[model samples]
Target chain A: MRQLSEQEFALIHARLKSLNIRYIEVYEEIFDHYCTTLENVPALDSQTTIAKLNETFACSVVKNMDKELEKSVSKQVWIAQLEFLKFWKHGVKGILIGLVGFFALAISILLIPASELILVFLVLIFCTTGGIYFMKRDAMNFSFQHKSVSVSSIAVIKRVGLLNSLMCWIWIMPIVLSGGNILSNNFFAIGMAVATILSIIYSISLIAVASRLPKSTLL
Target chain B: MSNNNLIKGSLQTIILKLLEENEKMYGYEITQRVKELTAGEIKITEGALYPALHKLEAEGLLSTEIQQVDNRVRKYYSLTKDGQKQVTSKMSELQGFVENLQRILTPDLKPGFNI
Candidate 1:
C-alpha cells in the first residue's frame, strides 16, 4: 500500500471543501472516509473504493445526494436536541436529580435577597453561555474546515439569547415602563422567581445536552 | 439478488445486527463487512448508507464517538441499549417479511400433498 504524501492529503481536503458540503459534522466524517478509502485501497488491489469516494463525494452528480446527506445529518442533530428535553422520561435517576435540582434552586431563591436575585440570574445565564462557547471552541478548528458557526454552536447561543430576551421582556419590562420596583412588588417578584427557577432548569438541561455533543454537532 | 429497494428497506436492520455483534463499527467498515459476507452480491451505495446511518442515529438507536486515526478522525457507531433491543425486533421483522414473500412466490408447494 502506498502512503499518500502530505500534498495529496491537502489536495483531498481542498477538493472536499468544494463539494458543497454544508455542515461541519458531515464534512468531517466524509473527509475521514475519503482519506481512509484512498489510503487503504491500493490502486493495484481495488481502485473501485477510490472511484466510489470520488464519484460520490468529489467528482460527480452526487452533489445533490450529498446535500441530502447534509440535510439528514442536520435533521438528526435537531432530533437529538429535542430528545434531550425528555431527560427524565425513562429513568428514576433523572427524575431524582431533577427533584434534587429544583429543591436546591428553590432554597437558593428563597435565601438570596430578592433585590439581588436579578444579578444572580444574569450571572447564571452569562456563565452558561460562556461555558458552552469554551466547550465548542475546543471541538472546532476553523483553519481545517471552511465553515460558518463552527458547529451550529452560534445558533444555539442565539437561541439562548432569545430566551434571555423573553425573560427580560416578561420580568424587567414592567419595572422599566412604569418606573417602579417590580422586585419589591409581591406578585411580580414571585412570578419572576418561578420563571427564573424554570429558566435555570432549562439552561441546565440545554448545557447538559450541549455538553454531550462531541465533534458531531453541526449546523 | 441485487435489489436496491430490498436492501434499502433492511439497511437499518443490517446495521443494527452488525453493531449488536461487533459492538462498534464505522461507516466504511460496515460497507466492507457487508460486501465480504455477501461475496460482493450486495454493495451498499455511498448515497444510501450515510443517510440511513443518520436516520438511525436520530432515532436514538445508535451513538457515535470520534477517535483520531493516523491523520484523520473516524466516527464509530455503537448500539445503544435501545439499539440492541431493536436489533432483535428488526431481525425478526425481516425474517417474517422473507417468509411471507416465500409463501407468495411458491404457493403451489404444499406439505403432505403429492400431486
Candidate 2:
C-alpha cells in the first residue's frame, strides 16, 4: 500500500474539518481510513483519491459523522454523570458529617436574634451565587482549553452548565420571592437545607462535566 | 456490501469476533480484513464501520488506543474485559441464530422436517 505524504494527510485533514469533524479522535480515524482505501486503489494520485473519497462519502457523510459524534459526545457525558454519581456515593460519609456539623451551626444561629438570622441568610445567598458563578466560569474555561473539540461537544458542556444554573435558580427563587418570610418562619431551616443539597449536587455535576473537557484536546 | 441488510444486524458481532481473533485492528484494516476474509463478498462500508466502532466503544464492548505511525495517528480498537465476555456470548448467540436459519432454509437438514 502507498503511504500518504504529509501534504496528502493535511489535505484530508482539512477536508474532514470542512465537513465539521472537529474532534481530533474522529478526524484521525477518518483520515486513516480514506488514506488506506486510496492506497488500495493503485495508480490514483492524491488529488484524484481525495475527489473519489469525497464522492464516495458524499451520500451520508455529514449525517453519519454527526450522528457518530453526537453518540460519542453523549457517551462521554454519560460516563461523566456516572462518575459524578460514584463521587456522591463515596462522599456520602463526608456529606453526612458535614450535614451534622451544619445542622449544629444552624441551630446555634437560630438561637440568635431574628436580625442576626437575616444577616446570615443574606450572606448565604451571596456565597451561593458566588460559588455558582465561579463554577460556571471554571467550566467555560475548561471548554475553551480544548481548541479542536467539536461544536456539538461544547454545546453539551454548555447545556450541562445551563442546567446547573437553572437548578440554582429553582433553589434560590422562592427564598428571594418570599422576601425572607420563609426565613423568619419555621420553614427557614428546611429551605436552607434544600438549597444546600441542591448546591452540592450542582457542584458535583459541574466538576464532572468540566473534568471531561480537558480530555477533548486534539491528538 | 452486497447484503447490507443482512450484515447490518450482525456488524457489531462480526467486528467483535474479528477483534477477538486479531487482538486489535484499525478501522480500515478491519474493513479490508472483512473483505479479504469473505473473498470480497462482504465489504464493510466506511459509513457503517465508524458508527459501529463508536457504538461498541460507547457500550464498553470496545476500547481505543491511538498510536503515531509514519507521521500520522492511527486509532486502534480492541475488546475490553466486558467486550471479551460479550464476544463469547454474542458469538454463541449468532451461532444459534445461524443454525436456526439453516434449519428453516433447508428443512431437510433437520431430522423430522419435510419440505
Candidate 3:
C-alpha cells in the first residue's frame, strides 16, 4: 500500500475531526481505517478518494460507532472504579482509605443542618467535577489540540463525575420538596446514608482511577 | 455484507478466530482479511466492525495497542489470554451451529426424521 501523503492524511484528519468524535482512541482507529480503505481504491486522486470515502463512511455512521466506543470505555472505567472499591481483595489500603472517606462524609452529613444539605450536595458535585478537571488536566490540553479526548479522561468525567453528581441529588431532592420533614424518614435517611458511603468510596477510587490513566496520551 | 443478519451473530467468533490465527490485527486489516478469506462474499462494515471490537475489548476477550504507522497512529488488537480461551469455545459453538444448519439445509446429510 502507498503511504498517504501528509496532505492526504491531513485532509482525512480534518474530516474525521469534523465528525467531532468524543474519544481520541476511537478517532485514531477510524482515521486509519478511512485512510487504509481509501488507499486501497484503485488509482483515484487523493481528493477523489477522500470524497468517495466521505460519501461512503458518512459522519453519522462513524458518530454512532463512536457512541458505542464511548459506552464500552465508560463501562470499563465504571467497573474498574467499583473494583477498586473492593476493600478486601483489591487492597487493605483502599479499605483504610474508604473508611476514612466514609467517616468524614458521614460526619459531614450528620452535622450539616437539613436546610443546608442541598448546598452541600452542590458543593460535592462541584468538587468532584472540578477535581476531574484539575486531575485530568492533560485531557484538556490534548482536546484543544486534537479536538478529541483520551478514553480514560472522558471516562473519568462522564462516568464518575457526572453520574456521581446525579446520585447526590437523590439524597437532597426529597429533603427540599417535603420542607425538611423527609429528614425524619428513616428509610430514606438510611438509603441516603448507604449512598453517601458508597459515593465517598467511589470518589476516593476516582483518584486512584484518574492517576492510573496514561500520562502521555498521543497528540 | 449481503447476509448482515447472518454475519451479525458470528462477527465475534470470526474476529476471535482470525486473531487466533494471525496473532494480531488492526481494524482495517481484520476487515480486509475477512474479505480476502471469503473472496468478498462477506464484508464487515466499519460501523459494525468497531463496536464489535470495542465490545470484545471491554469484555476482556481482546486488548489494544496504539502505534505510529504510515504517518498516522494505528490501533492494533490482539487476543488476551481470556480471548484465546474464548476462541476455542466460540469456534466450537459456531461450528456446532453451522453443522446443525447444514443438516437443515441438506436433509440428506443426516438421517431423516420418521415422525
Best by lDDT: 3
Taking the tens digit of each residue's C-alpha lDDT, what string does model 1 give over B17-100? 989989789988998899999999998876787777877876779988878887667889999989988988999898878777
Give the candidates in order of lDDT, highest first: 3, 1, 2
Clash pairs (backbone) in predicted model 2 = none
Order of candidates by TM-score, top first? 3, 2, 1
lDDT of 2 by residue, A1-219 (tens): 776667776787677766765455666677677877767776456678789788756646656765786777677666766666554475878578667856865675658654355455445545644554444442243453333454334545565556556655754576689875665665566555555555555555555565455344454
| Each candidate's DockQ | 0.31, 0.56, 0.67
What's the lDDT for all of these models? 0.70, 0.69, 0.77
How many clashes does the backbone of model 3 have?
0
Stretches off by above 4 angstroms in model 2 are A39-45, A87-156, A168-189, A205-214, B111-115
Between candidates 1 and 2, the one scoring higher on TM-score is 2
For candidate 3 chain B, the 10 contiguous residues with the lowest summed lDDT are B106-115
Indicate the worst ten consecutive residues by lDDT in candidate 2 chain A: A138-147
The TM-score obtained by model 1 is 0.69
When summed lDDT is taken over every stretch of 10 residues in candidate 1 chain A, the lowest stretch is A148-157
Q: lDDT for model 3, please.
A: 0.77
Models sorted by DockQ, best on top = 3, 2, 1
lDDT of 2 by residue, B11-53 (tens): 9999999999988999989988998899999988778888888
